[model samples]
Target: MSSPVNIPFLSFISLDREAKTPIYLQLAQQLINAIQRGYLVPGAKMPGSRKLSELLSLHRKTVIAAYEDLHHQGWIAIEPNKGAFVMDNKTKMVERPYDALVSLGNYPTQTGYSFKQSNLLDNPFEESNCTYQWNDGLPDVRLTQFNQLSGLYSASLKRKGTAKKMSNNQASIYFKEQLSNYLNSSRGLHISKDNLLITRSTEMSLYIISQLIISAGDVVIVGELGLFTANMIFQSAKANLQTIPVDGQGIDVDALELKLTSTKIKAVYITPHHHYPTTVTLSAKRRVKLLQLAQEYGFVIIEDDYDYDFQYEKSTIMPLASADLNGMVIYTGTFGKSLAPSFSTGFVVAPKNLISEMQKYLGLLDRHGDVIMQQVLGEMIAEGDIHRHLKKSLKVYMERRDNCCELIAKHLGERVKFNKPSGGLGLWLNWQAPISLLQMAKFCTQKGLFIPKNILYQNRNFTAIRLGFGHLTMEEMEKSLEIMGEYLSSLP
Candidate 1:
């Protein structure tokens, strides 16, 4: 019979009683360190838990837990009747002292590995040191019912079965159905869930649509003065973007028609409902003409109805997609402007086949959206909470818009020319003076007001500003406009 092996307990194997780390983990880690440092040889037998506990003045269970942890981590192994033994070392090689002295700049740049950045990356907006900011347009988040939304989110979280079902695109079904119903009733569009693809934002929807339809060197039409972000997206897609003049009645379809007669246009992007920067709704005659032209030329109409729910003057016009019969119109909209911008929810309404294709691209871009948020928003829509909220917000915003327009007239007067926008959140003001918009923006900044470069629209023939009123309170609007008025008065 073999004699019983005697295992030595090293003096360094002491535990710190005051340390926050538990005894078992400390012991396990220390043993691992010992093996890595070559102090404990491979396949060396360890003291039995009973003997170790006696030697270390610990409970037998504590020592057993330490050994079990080591065994689980593959640092050591235990035999049936025998004690624990150290396994072979798997630690990484130690770094040399000289390696730490090497500078990051010592490595040479790889040859023939150049990065070509896109021109679209030159962002026009600059961060300013101003207290009051004039945005393009955004919703006031203070009006949102956070308590109710939070409750709904919590309730959805508790429903584990429902959440499990939603893991594989099932969660968006109910929300999409509710959204479809709402859009059909409100926007006069006849669409089902199959025609919709919910996205993270309107930007994402635009990106997906651009990817699907606009190929390299394809001729796409946009308003001469249009949404800059959307134009950037089309440009990034390598499309040859042709610009059509925008007048008081939105994009000039006559110019579009002339272009069509000469060129093979693939798509025409427009903001029909309260156009961007200008806020001019395309006239009814122009709408019909544009739709007919789309049929005649076989070009797709991409209509972005960003702030359709905030109309205060006449009844809102139905989207171009509502009147599209030839399947040439693709309508995209967002709830961000209607609700809080942070609660982003945008959707695209198109032919079923196009929607199916958009979903494939959407999957590649984003595998899933916020399921709980969608579920909560769907409930709000079904219960009419969203409609009620919109109604309340419309009343408040109408008052704000009126106040802002009146203030603009009182302060800036005839120096700035503007038409009171009937439906949108901004008033498109054209600078009648020969002052440079870049200089005016700088003057405003000096007076503690920030007007982003992107919001200050300027081309060779036009100079304008889209002063948004939705997000500002009456007091803020008054203060900001007063500063702007002072700057304009001081300008030569």
Candidate 2:
């Protein structure tokens, strides 16, 4: 038999009596580690239980238990008198240094293999620790009625029928039916549960749709100033993106019509209810013209009415999908936009055939959907909690919108120009002064405000900003805008 290898076992085999793990199991694991690392070679004689116990200052019975565990696990063998021996692993040991062997247990910082990367799909959102922040039109989560939602969710959990159905991995059929009815009543979307596919977010809906429609090098059109994340998705799918002009009345239908005469366009993406970054609603005439053009040109229209629920002006305009008789439109929006951050709950409204196909792709992407969250939201709709919540929240948001517009007009004076958007949570500010937006963002950051770069649109022709006021209180909005005004005043 080979002699026991001279390894400093104390260097690596550490024990903590305070830890929840029992001492015997920890010792057994550490011994296995030593054997695998070649510090204890095959056929080597291990120190006797009593001898090792004295060397390590542990009870003999603890060492004996560890040895018995190793023996049962096949890592070692024990004889009546010879004691424990390391078992042969059938492979030659490399016998690396102690420090090198310890380092090898750590995870690699980067991949060892090469792969493709797409700069087009890089994340544009940034994280910061600043005192204040801005986003591109998101609802204020603080205003959400979370207590009511939590009660609803708790009730759902206690229901035996829901628990049994969920255990079998069934989709939330009730939520789909309730959501479909809500959309039909609110958005004028003529659809049933079969025409809907619930998604984690509108971004996920856009991605799944892009994959099904856009082939490599296919022509996809958008406004010259479009939603940045949506553009990234289309480009990542290898679509040849083309941009038409957007003005005060939304996307220039004439420019789009002119482009259609020459190119075989695959689809056109729009935030028609309130154009992203600009907040201009597509005019009634343009809506009719655009629908006519879609039929004539045979292209898909992706309408993202993200903030349709928060309109403060005269009754909100119905989405284009409401009047989509020929089924040329695919409408997407969030169902829980007014609720707390727990649910992102986005739904896509399309023809039943297309929805059936999208469901397959959705299954591949999000195999296990959030059934519990859906159940809670469905309950909210059924009990009219959603309608009540929106009605109560709308008044508060309207006040904030009015206060934000007044502050901008009063403090900034002639330095900035904007329209009080009729519906969405944000206002589009067109900077009139000659100031670099990047430099202004840096200046704001210095004064404890974090203006995300994605919200700032700057190029040679124009400098614009989409300042979201919905997420901030009146006091916060005042402070943020004051800092912004101070920076603009100091600029030449």
Candidate 3:
């Protein structure tokens, strides 16, 4: 009824007349982006909706709608007497380790390495053919049997027993048993329902593990060239990451012992089944030593079996979890790579002693994952569709892996060195380098080829890059690698 209010805040919000987004959504996205990017900090009050709308020459309803959406997404909150304010610490880093990597120059140069923080991106896998391919990730479409999934989704939602369970805030009992059985058969893990905590993805499991095991200022150890996401997670937990050098077998256990001589290491995370980027299966000998170290040093071991399902040349290697005499290894495995990414189901087999605390902590963030998807996956496995799908995918990925590796051999195997891993997707190439892997990654991009930067650096040089061929056809793989190898030849 009175004159429209004027807002001094939100001065930077400019309405775009030609954008595909609606007026309110455009305003919401801009505000959320600003807050997320640290342009706006927490405890800063937002402009009144009426005032903002009036200033922008829009109706009050429009601005109110935007504010409502932001509140729902946990980006902003409103108190009874107080106006809305940005949520605290959504983008704020709880813990970060800036000192560890910075002090690399001071680290006794056993692992030839200068840590580059920019190499934090995991495999750049998307559904479309738009993004660059990194050798370490699984395909998007290979996540689940979607048609069967859709049917299960509908049935689960409509089924009488499930509705009753959902009404009472519980999941189907049928699913719990099936999930337990699936793990027991698939991974040789005889875990009870209590020991298995289901997560949307392995990343989710690691994040929960971060809360359980890692704390700010805790020391974390990983292979010299580690999985990008794990490195990021450790950093996010505010743990100092010391990269223990990895040789042909696995991470140097002797060096790890020496590095921990004066330090208090809380956790040592390893991808023993198929070490990312390098594709080195951790030797049985090293695995034994690692387990021994965990017991003697009183540190936890997180074994991430990310890609154990895709063995190209031989029998599947027994996972280190099978040898956990002490409940030290926090073992994790995912159906994301071997099956499909969308179905993103993974489990953490923790020590029976730690399971209760882990569940309480897990419940605080996300309780059990979606019941519908869980039930679907459970049924899929019980029906043998999961194993069937995995074997089919293995066939497809193996051919691609061979084609890519063979091409690399044709072009540069004489100069470069790499072990022919009996199983696993992608080739871990070692170019005993005078040429930097980072430099080659840049040149290869210009030539329409995508490869991973050499994740193996001891102190200062990257002599290798992981070249993935799983997603490409034989011809595309050959063409891309041929161009990539030629460019590497041109270097130095």
lDDT values, one for every candidate: 0.83, 0.86, 0.71
Residues 122-221, candidate 1, lDDT per residue (tens digit)?
8866786688989887778887777877787789778866757476766699889999999999999999999999998888999999999999999999
The Cα RMSD of model 3 versus the native structure comes to 11.9
Q: How big is the positional error of residue 280 in model 2, measured in Å on the Cα after superposition?
A: 0.9
Candidate 2 contains a number of clashing pairs equal to 0
Best by TM-score: 2
lDDT of 3 by residue, 226-295 (tens): 7878888888778888888887788888888887788889998898877886888888888889889889
RMSDs, each prediction?
8.0, 3.1, 11.9
Ranking of candidates on TM-score, top first: 2, 1, 3
Report the lDDT tens digits of candidate 2 across residue range 1-492: 344445556666777788898888888988887776676777677889987888778999999999999999999989887778788666553433554344222345989899998888888999899998988888888988777778877887788787665866454678889999999898887788899999998989999999899999999999999999899999999999999999999999999999988999999999998898799999999999999999998999999986888888876789999999999999998888987766758889999999999999999999668888888888888889889999888888999999999999877888789988898899999888557888888999999999999998888888888999988998999888888888977866
Q: Which is superior by lDDT, 2 or 3?
A: 2
Give the deviation of candidate 1 from the true structure as CA RMSD. Answer: 8.0
Q: Output the better candidate (1/3) by lDDT.
A: 1
Residue ranges of candidate 1 with Cα displaced over 4 Å? 1-100, 103-113
